[model samples]
Target: MLPWLLCALLGVLVLALLGKVCALTRSMEEICDQLADRLAGDTNNLLTLSTRDPHARRLAARLNVQLRLLRQQRRRYLNGDRELKEAVTNLSHDLRTPLTALCGYLDLLDRQETSPAVARYLDQIRSRAEAMKALTEEIFRYSLLAARESWDWEDVTLNQVLEESLLAHYGALTQRGITPQLDLTEVPVHRRLDRKAVSRVLANLLSNALKYSAGDLRVALTPAGEITFSNTAPGLTPVMVGRLFDRFYTVETGRTATGLGLAIAKLLTEAMGGTIQADYRGETLTLTLRFPPAEEKAAPRAVPGGGGVE
Candidate 1:
């Protein structure tokens, strides 16, 4: 009697175990179906395959991390592509304006009857052509500055460069009747910068000052080597000041300037490890260019002379 009872109990235990095994198998199948659906819908999905197993959970976590990285990379790629397209469009439009102007000027110069008036017209055409050429060169320089590549730096004298730039623009300043007050110190200050880049920046600033300033223009170089160019022009509003360094932003009067001068100046200054800022105070527009301090090992001695525009 005892043996028979034990056999019945063992058979009942075996049946219960079999039932649990079958239930687990069904659960696994459902989990697999769900996983397959998710994978088919989106390869980027992070959900794990259906299973009551620890291994699936670990795999899903690892896969989620990889998916996140891939998504970030994809987003960056899309953004870069969009920016490239926009840059190309802007380049095309800017180039078209100058090229069209050149074509029209050439056509005018090719006409019959070369009278004095015709000669004057030809001179005007030539001037416009030169302006267009300068515009193209500036655009190219701006593009180069905008690129992510680095530039070669050399030790250059800031005071000397400033003097040379001012001298070069002396004729234009005289023609425009704008007197430049130079407050330069005789101290020779050395800075690690690209010479060409610094010259371009000064040229742009001086050109803009001559073009826009209706009154006195003051360029002061401090003992600490902070150079400020201030012109007595109409005060700019806060909004205009905010966008003053922006590309293609002309003033309220719709000036004929290409509006890239200040923007390029700011960019090159920064690239050469310097800083630039624009401020409007008391009926004057001031643009400041600050260079990094000279290295301690360098010897600086003489105080520079004061020169005014003739």
Candidate 2:
């Protein structure tokens, strides 16, 4: 009788240990779910487990501490980003007045007659001044976009927009002695987009091609809303192509580039729920842009990592 009683006691102890283990496992599973949701920007709930086991309690506590640290770091990053945007805005605004004055002086000088040597010097000064002015304007526009300016969205015909943009740059293309190969869809592809923003994107791409094209530029737009711009770039490497959209990043081949054109295009494209990517192979560089159709434009746009043209 005594042996049987001791066996029963041991059996009860083992059952209790198994029960505790099961409870801890359930608690851990819930904690993991919550952590995953939080990391995906879907939830803000803190980890709370209802397990009485001391080991499980300690694990929960450690995870909560780490979550708190993560939240603190994210808060700091947001604050710093806001401050930087404000600084850029103010600096860009301040530089504009003097830039305008410089351009005005150059224009005045251009209107007056001078010797060929003096004319050459004045032309060089004018070119640099114009470049500076353009860069300043881009910086200002970038600041506004960073500050989240409101968009005037409408139903835009992308085909017409692209055609107009190409026509506008026809003179530039002719000057570069490169004939653009265009394969545009006959059917008009439409998207709920900002007309100005889309035009800017196309203009930036064409301007980049004009700057870096070896001798040819190929552009194609499909009925599915995929736009492709490809050109032969002589000295661009794969690494350079990867960082082409990064702000203020310029390559040795782009001597006069401000490096913000493609960056702005990326910002506007993403804001309008679109995707853009760049690829480089065997001295050829290509950029692809896609916009969701009007029916699907309401979905959230995922920000892509860096990619673009020179």
Candidate 3:
């Protein structure tokens, strides 16, 4: 009778322990869901546990404190970023008026040319002014796009976009005595992307090649929707390639560039559920960009529906 009674008591204890374990598990799951929501969104909600477990309550209290701190830091970052973008936009706007005036005066001076030396000096000044203007415009566009919270997303034929971008950069490539080798797959790789953003990304990559290529360029597109821009850039190193996508990163000789091209491309690519990478080996620099196919999964867009990237 004593052994039988002891068995019954043990069984009841086991049942209670099992119930407590299940409750704790449910509380942890709830905490995870709430944490994920808070991280992905701007919410002030804290973890709400249904279980009365003391351990679970303590964990929730700790997490709540962390969440509040996290929110404070996030708010500060957003505010700082907004201010920086506005500063960039305003500076670019202010510089444009003076730049236009400077270019006009240079043009006027060119028309009434004096000595050969003066003409040469004028040419140098004009070239420098043009370079500065291009840099300013690029910065302005990057600033606006960086602050962009929306994008036009639609079904885009990757092959067509690649071809168009190539054609557009043909003049610049040929002028540099570089004829790019092309190997594009005929299969139409389709993606839901911002056409303008993708085009801008291509333009930046090509422009990067123009600056760094050692007179050779090879472009290829795979059937699986991978586009690579390869160039024999003898001067580039693996270390340099690693930082290619960072904003305002430039090599010693490429000071004329604001180094925002690849940075903007990366920014836009990620925003569109795409990726961009750079690899350097044996004096060759290859830049690859990929976007998820539209058929695979639905991706968010700047607007619920639209197209293009910048």
**Whole-model Cα lDDT of every candidate shown, in order:** 0.71, 0.84, 0.85
What clash pairs does model 2 have?
none
lDDT of 2 by residue, 17-85 (tens): 999878988988978887887776734577877777778778878888888889889878778877877
Per-model TM-score on C-alpha atoms? 0.61, 0.80, 0.89
Superposed by TM-score, candidate 1 places the C-alpha of residue 101 at a distance from the truth, in angstroms, of: 7.9
Tell me, what's the RMSD of every candidate?
14.6, 4.4, 3.0
Q: Count clashing pairs, candidate 1.
A: 2
Better of 1 and 3 by TM-score: 3
**Higher-TM-score candidate of 2 and 3:** 3
lDDT winner between candidates 1 and 3: 3
- Candidate 3 lDDT by residue in tens digits, 1-310: 9999999999999999999989998999999998898898789888888888999999999999999999999889878867877898899989989998999999899889499999999989998999889888888887778666767667899999999999999999999999999999999988877788889988889999999988999999998889999988887778888998888899865868888889888887777877789988888889998876766544654421122244
lDDT of 1 by residue, 45-137 (tens): 655544555655675666567667876787687578557645844785578676777867677666866889878977787767766655665
- Comparing 1 with 2 on TM-score, the higher-scoring candidate is 2
